[model samples]
Target: MRWIEAWTKIQTLFIPGVAGLREVVQGTRTTHPSDQLQCPQDFPLLLPSLILHSVSYDRTLEEIKWKLHEGQAHNALNELCQVLQSRAYMLKFKDSFL
Candidate 1:
């Protein structure tokens, strides 16, 4: 199968408490206004909800593409690498002062 479809299937597997999550081939389920899902504060639920949320489907791939375009345009990958590199230093500084 195509990579995007494979990726989507893989992502569905990581969603917690969801059984048999499949791509909507026909249409979406109708939901009442008051029956909508509320975002939970717990990390386990929150992370999956954030990852699987409909808004992410539009922007995540674009964001990844932008981050991967290192030298062609803005070096977001370099900026991310710098942030990652500084993480340990920041933690050490915090531990020393706080």
Candidate 2:
């Protein structure tokens, strides 16, 4: 499926810097770092939350609170993921049953 492939590509894009990603996030604004992902199926804000959830250390909770206050992406992203999955499943059943 195209969506799976796309998600795979997105996962690959993230695979490179896991070791140094925290430093990169903390060190400098050389790049958004998160921009390298291809996440059409993902909530735009979900991407950052996903990253935060993944590599966040003890301070990540505080950081997440900050991001939540500053950005509306977290809630929006969760909703978007549910919507996309529901729609995708609907399409699948529609194609298969009808």
The lDDT leader among the candidates is 2
- Candidate 1 deviation (Cα RMSD): 14.2
User: How close to the true structure is residue 15 of candidate 2, measured as C-alpha lDDT?
Assistant: 48
Clashes of each: 0, 0
Report the Cα lDDT for residue 81, model 2: 100
Per-candidate Cα lDDT values, in order, are 0.48, 0.58
lDDT of 2 by residue, 1-98 (tens): 47655754664455433336534543453357775445544323224456655653455556767887767777788889999999999999999999
Q: Which candidate is the best by TM-score?
A: 2
Q: What is the TM-score of each candidate against the true structure?
A: 0.24, 0.30
Return the clash pairs for model 2, or none.
none
Candidate 2 runs further than 4 Å off: 1-65
Candidate 1, 5-81: lDDT as tens digits: 45555655544223233323211331466533343321122234444553234445556656766554556767888
* Residue-pair clashes, model 1: 0
Q: How does candidate 2 fare on TM-score?
A: 0.30
The 10 consecutive residues of candidate 2 with the worst lDDT sum are 40-49
Candidate 1 positional error at 57, Å: 33
